[model samples]
Target: MTATIHRLGRDQAPSLEPMMALVAEDMNSVNAVILDRMQSRIPLIPELAGHLIAGGGKRMRPMLTLASARLLDYSGTRHHKLSAAVEFIHTATLLHDDVVDGSGLRRGRKTANIIWGNSASVLVGDFLFSRSFELMVEDGSLKVLKILSNASAVIAEGEVNQLTAQRRIDTDEEQYLEIIGAKTAALFAAACRIAAVVAERDEKQEQALDAYGRNLGIAFQLVDDALDYESDGATMGKDAGDDFRDGKVTLPVILAYARGSADDRAFWKAAISGHRISDEDLTHATGLLRSTGAIADTLARARHYGQRAIDALGMFGNGKAKAALIEAVEFAIARAY
Candidate 1:
């Protein structure tokens, strides 16, 4: 998002130049295909969809789909369909997420739920989800359909589980992993696996892509969790304390709660579990997180997953595409800082 962390000004940050070039080389073309698919005979649907699509998502899911396909030298056009399908699924999830989280902002702008009414946002989200299925059907790939459908189901289940798990100070690392894997990594895994389906690649290659996506997605979400504890609106593109305020369970707070002293844990129980948090309560919670080194520790775990994602690419042959995959891994972790 923000030039992959550097000492110089954002304008002079080194990572964006190469990252942009690689993205253009690998993703820009497919992005156009994605745009084309979003068009419908009904003009308003397309227009509303366009507004969200052009909003500030990094489009990493679609990029992964396209790049994974390219890595296997997929020469077929169906990858475009699959890529667009992945983007549609992702956009649909974001729309649903805004409603579920009751979020007012994303990427420093009002969320779809805030701009359009929640009803319009929900319907538009459903439309995008249906469009994704349509694209998959047109591609005539049953495997792709199964993969994405399963991911969608898992995402929904994960959201429900996470909602129940929220503010429960006793939630463990295993539960945290399960929640993130279900809600975030499921789609990432599907995105990469569908590319293998399009390429008709070998089983081992497909597994590698799955592993890459799973680990990368885990890393990405972990960084996001850390950002809620460590970042401001300027860097994070959303209000700080939104996660805790929404009663969402995330890694840093989970870690802090686990390792905190008796008084600190009691404080969390009052503020988080008892739903007693105020502005002052948020500052106190952040202080507890800082004292426990929870944010730093969570970031270390995210970096480990990011490294695993890069290593998972070893099964693939050497190429610019492979390099791009590696860069993607680094980019996922870099966003934490």
Candidate 2:
């Protein structure tokens, strides 16, 4: 796939509303299942879980599940509950991630970890994982169970892999892809793939959906990493320099460091080693990223993956579902700007 990017302002760019509209009614059913399953006699269960659940997240993963099913022209209501399962898994991961990263803000609001504490966040994450498994079990498709369960395992492995690579400036592009493919793309693949199983489609169709979600997931993450430095706190919903302050060696840093002068390399080594993290340091880092063409190149890579995602849908016929899915790819790439 040729990665051609057409830059557009937020107002004129592709929107997610089309996809959301296509699945709006189905999402309501999924939301009902999510609300019902999150409840517990303990009371704290729903409170903490709901905190993030009700947060301003776009519910993209679950929406992918519903949209993929719609692309197959699924007639039954089975995708709704399964979509909730996908969401629970996603929310659980976010909770655990905030604690691991010691994050303070998400979607312009205080994180559950910050409000509820580390142990509470971790336990609630586990509870959500349990709820996801229960929903998967009720679906009674062994293939679906295996797909989602394996994704859960893969995500754990990816988290561990990222932890080891953290603050290590030597982490390469290939390894970074592997880490994100597991942590972020695995569930995305499963979320779309299961729709094929429920819709009783063949393996070819299932593989196509998996590819669509996987490529889109990678594109989504690359854009997020680029925005960590380029976007403001209000635009990003997290601190603008969170990755820099936390000593996370994302793609921008990796590329900048690789292409830097001796002094610039020293600066990067110091920055990723938990030093040089003041506001001015972040400013300097952003300048280095621009000078090295790292930010621009990172966005270019995202467009590559986004194009692959759009290409993965070529087998599907032209229709509202296909159009919305294609525009979703456009939106993901557009977010970096």
Candidate 3:
């Protein structure tokens, strides 16, 4: 088993540089497709979409598609356009999510919804969704289309699920996992699964890639959840207590609530019920999270999933692509550190 790499030493910190180098050429092609496809007669379509699209995201989903192809030793360029399509799907979700969450910042910058208003952001997101379908149709693979389209639907369902659970202090760990699996991990799985389809690989190989992506996605989300409470805004790329202020019952909060004292539980109920959103309350919440070991254990859960993601690649032969993907999992966990 490939052990989970810790980020205790900054000098040896895991980074995305390896994956970026591995996918540089193919990612360039995907970027060209993205730039060309984002153009439109209506100025706002491209402008608003570009604002978030060009935002400093790692483009992790599309990169997964490209890397998965390389892992299978695929030489064809079919995954390029599909990779752009995967990115478009991801960008569309981000735009809609910012609007729904009423988020003001992303990547340490103003969210599209904040700059263009909610309606514009949502409309532009719909435009991007249409663009993604066009790209998928151009790829002309029914399997790819089914995988991505189903992921899209599942993502929306997950968003809705989270919305319903929002501000409700009663949400549990199981429900939280289901929501993240749908909203975040669904596309990650689809991105890698479609690569196997385009590569003409066997079903077993496809399933392996899907599991790899899914577990990695879950680990990534878990880390982000921990960071929400453990990191500063500069490190988190957004507000530090955004999840807490918004009453999101992520795993850290779930664990803390379950293990909290009577007084602590009452505090959580009040904080999550939207009554304690001040800086002092957030400080208290953070102190509680630390005292109960919620944040550390949340990261432990992330390591568990990260290990699963690394192990999923066991059947693949050792090479640059496989090593990069493994490091990618390490980087995901290291983000919290």
Candidate 4:
């Protein structure tokens, strides 16, 4: 049987800005901490970090940290520092990822590596990683430190796993899910879990928040993978078919490849095997993804995870924060549209 695929519309998903407004006050504090911590005696450190930090990308991860904290009514200053740490970790990953992926653009601007060379990008990424650890240490919570620290390690492992799986057509859906979970979702889970820890909420609450983040992260990455094939440079902040050009086996490719005919499989095997891929190849691949319902199926999978993210919020009381958090899931899924 063929899979039923669902497509998202422009008005179908909720906006993230309203959800962000729900924690506008706390997010201001988090932003303050972020700017204050990015400073350095070495001119290049701040210059390079600031270039990316000020690039107008949505600060979603740190927003999650602050929103999670506020959801439990934690009126403490420590969450500020934790949220900044989350941003640092996220920024560091972007720096390193650009280098690893040889990306030239991010947030519709030149990537750090493209401007400053690979060494500078990599070192700056290291600097951000160290800064994140320092913030965790300053927070004085062993549990928070452990959660964020483990997330950092798991993210690295996920990067390596993705590297190992690169260009391999045999990469399965389960393996792809594992890679995204560790690389993207681990930090989301940590960010949400730390909020509960700081609030001194029960283990059940902590786990619930973690589950929400984990599922939300999966949905977010799935949409991102789909967008790489569907969006233009203006909308997606990068060129379309980047994943295909880079030989990265994202879910859209996986689903399409799995469901394709013999001739279709051969086409994918050649296109994804790191050969010289032309624009025409990408156009053809997009057609195949559409014809085989890969893009729609991928979005369907994102919706599934998005619903799980919403369900995970059932433990929280009904309020602006809870409603905003649920809407945030829809926003994450709607980016593709």
Candidate 5:
């Protein structure tokens, strides 16, 4: 079979700055809430949390919450707290993930676990998780509480599911989708749906936004998976080939393993079987991904999900927020470039 290489042209992919600009004012409010809620009398609590929070991520999840609220013309303060809560939940997951993965870098900086030790990182993660619940309670809406709280639980389940799939060469597309959906996309769905809920919108609108966020999150993770093979560490904000080293069975690996030649399959099976992966092994793995169209196929799946995310916004009327949300889908897929 011939490989179909996917190339990202410069003009085709727009920057994420516009999405951030569209919701700039609201994101500012979300940031304020994040800083305020992260504070505590104990210096270490704030210190550890701030370390990761300050290590600038795109803040995509919280921005989705803000933009989703704006899409529905929600003129309330409650979404602010909820957005911060979403961010806290995301950050808590990152802390725990670093510990689980034994990762030393995040967002191009030292991971909290590396700087503060695994014990502090784990404890701080728990603190942030509790802090997220506190924000939910402060919102005083049982419905909103249910959505976000359920998302947190789903995120945990996804992580465990991925752990179960780790280093297993036989992991397939369905299992990979389940892992990303639970680990990453669940919160995205909740973040967007809660906006419609706060606005007192009907169930249809809530479901639409939920669909949008869920598909976008899936696309986002697919791109990350591909980027692990294709990107330099600078672009990915983590070590290049981190997934290969960790024996994580992401979509790229699944597709490559399924399509590879006999020798190629053997190489992959050994590389990801929890053995010591040399630099040369990673180089060969990347070559197979490129030559077998795994990266392209993975990116095609991302674009598929991105289009679904855009389609989910059809119920909403035309406005800057709506347009920006659509562009956000483009940005999510384009990030791999």
Candidate 6:
């Protein structure tokens, strides 16, 4: 609760330059293919999918798909299909997450649940989830299907576990990692893994990509948690202190509480456990995080994961694509709101 959101000024993070270039290189064709594949058997399905698809996400997942494939020297067009598949899976989860969390806003706009209702959001999410499977099966690659299915299952199970464990002060970093891995990292892993799989990469290269994605996902979510404390809804596209408001425990607050003075720790116990965070108390908590360096420590951990993600690609040879992937690791941690 002590974490203060940090919004970036006009200076954009330099790390994104290479990744942005890669995105521009292939984004148009990739998006075209993705849009073409979104045609649904059910009319409402397309509408629901369209609502989420048009919401203007970073398209980070699909970009990773293309980048990975290109890095492995895949000149074929099948990567576009796999990229769309990865996007569908990601969008499906967002729909379901909004519904489960009862969140009203995402990315500074009304959530699907707010516009279409939870029932619609949940059902449409199911539709998208099924559609992703159908698309992958059409590709007729057993490896792709297996990897994506496993990721899907883990994402669902992770959300369920997080729901059950909400607001528990005792949640450790291990438990935190497990929950985020399933909920966030699984698709990142799958997206990267599928690229190597489709390219028929060697085992060592495949493993490297997997490690990169897994560590990148962890770093991404950790930074996400940090931003929740420091960013406003307009900038971050979500409510500030959303985790705290939802009675969820995240890293900054966890670290702060662990290192706080008796009274500072008691404030968290009372505010979180007894449900007593007021506007006044929120200001006090932010100050505590600044004073205690909990935010800095959590950011340091995210930096470590970010570096690991870059290091995972050391085995790969030189190329703009590989450099872009490496730059993405830095971008993941350094993004400002």
Note the Cα lDDT for every prediction shown: 0.81, 0.91, 0.92, 0.90, 0.90, 0.80
Tens-digit lDDT string for candidate 4 (187-214):
9989889999999999999999999999
Give residue 256's lDDT in candidate 1 (0 to 100). 88
Residues 1-337 of candidate 1 have per-residue lDDT tens digits of 3332211113322242343455465566667866887787877667767778888877888878877887888877787777788889889888888898889888887787887778877888898999899989998989889999999999988888888898777778999999999999999988998889888887788888999899989998999998886788888888888987876768888888889888887887777674756888888888888889998899899988888887888778777777777777776777766
TM-score of each: 0.91, 0.96, 0.97, 0.96, 0.96, 0.92
Candidate 3 residue-wise lDDT, 252-272, digit = tens: 999999999999999999999
Candidate 6 local lDDT, 1-337, one digit each (tens) = 3532222222655476687687575767778866777776777777777877887788888888888887888877777777788898999899989988889888788888888788888888877777778888888899899989999999999999888768777777888889988999888978898889889988788788888898899989998988877778888988887777676777888888888999988887776663756767767777777788877877888888877887788777777888788778777777633
Poorest 10 consecutive residues of model 5 by lDDT?
Answer: 1-10
**CA lDDT for candidate 6:** 0.80
Q: Give all candidate RMSDs, comma-separated.
A: 4.7, 2.7, 2.3, 4.3, 4.7, 5.7
Q: For model 4, which pairs clash?
A: none
Instruction: For candidate 1, give the lDDT.
Output: 0.81
Q: Candidates 3 and 5: which is better by lDDT?
A: 3
Worst 10 residues of 2 by lDDT: 1-10
RMSD of 4: 4.3
Better of 2 and 4 by lDDT: 2
Q: After superposition, how far is residue 148 of candidate 3 from its true place, in Å?
A: 0.5
Model 2 CA deviation exceeding 4 Å by range: 1-11
Backbone Cα, N, C clashes tallied per candidate: 0, 0, 0, 0, 0, 6
lDDT of 1 at 288: 86
**For candidate 5, what's the RMSD?**
4.7
* Regions of model 1 farther than 4 Å from truth: 1-20, 23-26, 40-44, 274-276
The digit string of per-residue lDDT tens for model 2 on 1-337 reads 6644433224677999999999999999999999999999988889999989998899999999999999999999888889999999999999999999999999899999999899999998999999998998998889999989999999999999999998898988989899889999899889999999999999999999999999999999899999999999999889898989888888888899999999999999999998899999999999999999999999998989888888888788778998888888889889876
Clashing pairs in 2: none
